[model samples]
Target: MTMELGLLKALLNKDFYEKNRGLRCPPEIFSKDVRKIKDCLDLAMEKYKADLTTEDLQAVFHATNKTMTTATKVSYDDLFRKMQSTKAIHGEIAEDALSSLFQQYVGEQVAQMGFSFVNGEEESLEPLRRLLDDYKNDFTPSIRVDWDDISIETLMAANKQESQWKFNIPSLRKKIEGVSGGHLIMVGARPNTGKTSFHASLIAGPDGFAHQGAKCIVLCNEESYERVGARYLSAATNMTMDEVHSNVSLAAERYDTVKQNVRIKDSTNKNLSWVEAVVKHEKPDIVILDMGDKFSSKTSDKTDVYLKDASIYARNIAKQYKCAVIWMSQLSAAAEGKVFLDQSMMEGSKTGKAAESDLMVLISKNPQVEGADEQDTQRHLNIAKNKLKGGWHGVLHCDLDGDRSLYTS
Candidate 1:
């Protein structure tokens, strides 16, 4: 019957509520008679986040408004009937109507201000200027927020994606669960400490990320693309280069299973901006930056500032593109001939790289024997920083099969 109840009905429509629920349609616009009802509707919509029926509002109001008097109850029941008989308007027409009402309210405030100015209750035009300035951005509602689900139901279900994209390495999986989208995992090691092979094993080896159905792209600025491609070849077939040459047909057959998932590019002389462009074009599920530190230019004399800025860009790319980024880095000479490594051992800058990463796995090699000619295959994966799954920090022992370019327990 009343325009207030009709406006309330339009607010209940799913399309209108989703667009104009927040500060755009505050309960202050409603008259005192149905203002409480509008407040009830606001609370219900936020919790339920669904198109609510007339009965739903009545239930929510009564269930929450338990202390009301009998006369007030009868008046509210009459108001509900008026809302029930009203039809909701939709689309652009509804939005325009709502905008008109909000502007009318703003006009009423200015009208009051004019009265005050005329009656000598106000001095300068400063109050009117301040009022217009404050309302400038309220018309558009420019902020689009994606509210996180805080329900107890989301506590475990929030991690469902990570579990779906499970890690293939059994030992590492036992510590921190797996990585999903928005993960920046920085892998660091000395030059000959299987730096390239570690990723080759996790990405190209049997039962790796590629086999797990991830679209993988490797951008190598350190090694030639051909060299990186060869490692991937050895990893996919679990064979040495010599063995692959001898059994080309069998290796090709084995590589074919995950060949479509893998892509290698020579990204030499490229910066983070170029990397972002490739990511935007290809839209891969997993990205690897072999030698990720070289992506930044030394704009400042401080190595820490530039390196930290580069890592920030890398982190943003991972989050915006909804992909997991594996940043390959080299450890400094302080880490050489050492059995243990930490975040401080990362090359170039001290804490810049580790600070931005969600997980930092610093790989260290075992000390060499006095007369041994063979390179060390034993590695200790020190998880210096972990913000994923269990948040565990410790070492996991694994062996790097250099010939096959695979790491195994």
Candidate 2:
């Protein structure tokens, strides 16, 4: 008869109906909840009628309170108010009496709503599909752009007259092209193999990405941002490794030059949401995700769910921003051998990260040399795939010194 007990009954009745109407919960679910709530209420009423003494009432109070609290996972205020008016266990007793009770039946019914799907279950797939569909359509065309006046011929003629001539003439003549427009390029290698240096070289070296009108955002997943900057500065300014440490001013100059073309960012926290925000805001043509391990540990399980979700995120960012999204993926055991070209090597996430990528490049240590000159020709750059260009594997490019922005013959 207490206000709290009355509220408990109301809550249980409502909760039972709400849970049982679902696709998963059935009539048995509701019946179980009802029995639990009813049992607790009955015990509380009997205790109240038997004894009005503080200790006696406290026992009944505790029992009835326990029942109501466990009967349905409802809030305390409503139940307490009801008990105060009807059962009349007013003031401090009702307030402090029963606060910690929660029912297993209620929890069982509610926990299902929070469960996550494993792998490619229909529940998981549906949301992912919708997200992908939305990404494809999110970037609307700017209204003021002269769509009617745009033409390939006109664009080509304009390019012929503009500075783009520099970019195109070389492509047309030597077939050597430069990447622009927030393009993502991946440079992968095992630990301490100069992947960071390679990225720095591309952004700061004389003939690097900056010269090609590309601003590089280097996310140093493994190292501190300052360390990455030092390496890049040393490479770009042509300073001796020792001199870079002694001359802070030279490093500053190199930093300025780097900022002009490439904006360096670090991914030490394992969160990629920052990278996505940078892409949307800065719209850099060349965004390098550095190594795949930096894309947050949430995707670390290598499950089908993780792969599909992570790959879709990378691909959508690339397509939405009209930039090349390059993810640095690890090769599987097979990739270490001749059969490594298959998608298994991307560590953590599935092969979809590699397969969905616009381009996939594998950087591996060259096993050929063993003598004095071996250090000079240490690493081999394999263009394992260019999915945008039909997944073609090109000739191997070697980086001997590993100081150059690019590897060449």
lDDT tens digits, residues 1-409, model 1? Answer: 3666877887787677877776677777778878899999999988898888988999999999999999999999988988898776655666676777777777888999999999999999999998788676566533336998888778767676764456667798778767877889999998888888888888898789899999999999998999889999999999999999999999999999778999999999999999999999999888999989888877778988898889989999999998999999988899898877889888887788899999999998888789999877888999999988779998999988989989888
1-409 per-residue lDDT for model 2 (tens digits): 3443433333233333232222222123233433344444445444333223223333444555565544443543343444445543333333222221222333443344335453323464565455345434422322333455558998676445322212222211133243433234444555445666665655566566566666567666766888777776666776656776688787677657656776667776655677788888987766777665457436545465675576677667766786655566455554452412334554554555655654455666644344645365545555555533224465354453453333333
Q: lDDT score, residue 294, model 1?
A: 85
User: Clash number for model 1?
Assistant: 0
- After the best TM-score superposition of candidate 1, give how far the Cα of residue 253 lies from its true spot, in angstroms: 0.8
Task: Write down the TM-score of every candidate.
Answer: 0.67, 0.51
Candidate 1 segments whose C-alpha is farther than 4 A from its true place: 1-144, 152-155
Estimate the TM-score for candidate 1: 0.67
